[model samples]
Target: MSLWKNRNFLLLLGGQGVSEFGSSITYVAMPLVALTVLDASSFEVGVLTAMSSLAFLLISLPAGVVVDRSARKKLMLWSNVGRAALVGVVPLLAALDALEMVHLYVVAFFVGVLTVLFEIAYQSFVPSVVTKDQLVDANGKLSTTQSLSVVLGPPLGGGLVALMGATRVMAVDALSYLVSVVSLLLLPMREEPPAKTAGFSWDAVRRETAEGLSFVFGHPVLRKVVACTATSNFFGAMYFALEMVFFVKELNAGPLLIGLAISAGGAGGVLGGLTARRVSTRVGSARMIWVSVLGLGWTGVLVPLAGPGWGFALIAVGLFGFSLSAVLYNTAQVSYRQAVCPPELLGRVNASVRWVVWGTLPVGALVAGWLATSLGVRETLLVAGAGGWLAGLWVYFSPIRGMRDVPTTEPVTA
Candidate 1:
């Protein structure tokens, strides 16, 4: 039977799809808000983005332990509620003309913390809802929708911004979390109760944190995954911090065109999503990693080379290649992790992996802003593209490059 026929999976997809779209909306609208309404400088905008990403660095370890200990459903539920309230406050403040950079900072940081909880829980929660063998298909489906969200969200947000303004678009983001909460509430399956033996303590946090970290670094496949993902995210952040600025200033793109550029780049993501499993199965998983990250990842450099009008076509062309390969790479890696990692350690492992990979984003974001201030946008993008191209070499040299399939979990290393 197809996994799509499963009711709970569908709910998970629908709810997350809605929320993803909402967040993507913010991706476009947030910078526009900073640039247009608040008159934030490029550096200030980077700071705001950095503040949000700071949570992965600040709390990812503890958050992982917490997700492992708690009911993932409840954690996700409360996390969404918190996010809803935090983000919803923005529009209210905007209406009252009371919104400020400080408010954005506070919201970004706290919401980021909740996001850590939600994402760890979400990644850990998936295996409970499906058989172990179905993981790739499940991840592929989710990734496909995720790519679709990227394809649709920006343009939708851009159109709304054109009509309703960015604050209103943020309000829509808050509403999307509510939709995710509803989906969580309706899930037919429940997260396995956290192992009774694992109790809470500062000692437990430190020990378990080490265990999670050890698993990621100790495992050959996971180690490479971390290296490549971290490098991509770091450089991606440097590029992303300046991307909106690039579109507006360098290409002289309006909001719609900016959305188009991002969407076009991701056009291949949908294709990648649909084919990742098939391609990886046909070739080898390790080869797919190199192909996706190394082969397609470098195309992102084309964004800097683009000009306005017909010349802007380069962004879409580059994005199509980059996005396709990235989605393929991610779906394979995530499925491999979910399939191989021990259940007791899933939350911690996911969090540990995220800690290393996502933690770079803030640093990258801040650096991009600073670089844009001193070096300029195109140069920053050039560096970002080249960095992305080289990000996967660690994988190429590691055992991950030679593996035919994900390996079984190894004994926990001290």
Candidate 2:
């Protein structure tokens, strides 16, 4: 069936797309606001970022439990509302000339907390609303929206910040959340009931969490996917933390240039997501995964090699985007995981996998900062790039490389 025929998916995609665009604004605006407006140091900015992801790591498992128990729609709605309210505070404080780095940090923390909940609910809800046959298509379309948001969000944010100031740009982000909340509220489907257990107990939660972890690590397919994904995310986080430094110090690129570079990467992501299905069909899922991992990892190597000119920087950004095979890999992996996992365990499983995979980001960011400070930004890029490439080889050599497609029939329990 055509993707557009599914109204629930449409609303979900639309809301998520809008919300992501807003997030992209904050992603760009936050550091600029901290640095330019608040006159914060690199350390302070790092703290803000670290706090953001730290909340995700801390709250992920709990959020998964909550998502499993609660009405997913309500969870999504409340998440967006909470995020909007928190983001709105920034602009309001700025208008009163009372904005402080502390205020931004607090808002960032709350937003991150709510986002973890929203994401858990969203991921869990997808399989319920769409059939197994539609999983990859659903993921591809969602990835496309995300890619578009990435492309549009930075430039739009930059323009807004440039015109009305960073504070006002945050207001736009707040509005986007409100829109997302409404869209989710309008979704036609209800979430599947959570799996029933004998009773609620700490042991139950522990067992459930462990089950999810085992599913990811014990299964041959999931094991390699997780390894490749976790390793790639580690390096990706490092690149993200240090990209601004590379632009400013190594390339002498300004804010607009940074936005442009990000937009270029977004363009690549859009391309990857759009063609993911065809690529998977042509090359096979296993081969596609390997290609994307290698491509994404190698892109980092070229970052440090870009010349100190806009033309060269743009090329680097485009290549960086082109090398990002993760979007497709992630799309495929999520779909496969959803199809094979018991319906009742979806939330816990998704959350558990995400917790482990994403848990490395902060560590990677910290390492990137330290390495950049000690060895220089270029050297840091070289190291991260090399490490990422080596990490990709894990998937290349593993069982994941041999699998051709997700099982067409229901997966038998191990």
**TM-score of decoy 1:** 0.96
Supply the global lDDT for candidate 1.
0.85
- TM per candidate comes to 0.96, 0.93
Enumerate residue pairs that collide in model 2: none
Q: Which residue runs of candidate 2 sit more than 4 Å off their true CA positions?
A: 197-201, 311-324
lDDT of 2 by residue, 122-236 (tens): 8888877788877887888888888888788887777777788888888888999999988987887765566653466877767766777777677776777777777877777
Specify the highest-TM-score model's number. Answer: 1
lDDT tens per residue, model 1, 1-414: 588799989999899999988998888988888888898888988898899899998899889899888898899999999999998887888899998988888988999999999999999998888877777778888988888888998988888888999888899999999999999899878655688356678998999888888888888677888898999999988888888888877877888878877787556888888887798788765467776787778788887898878989888888888888789888888888887788888889999999999999999999999888889888988999889879978778887766776543452342
Q: Quote model 2's TM-score.
A: 0.93
Task: Please state the error at residue 137 of candidate 2 in Å.
Answer: 1.1
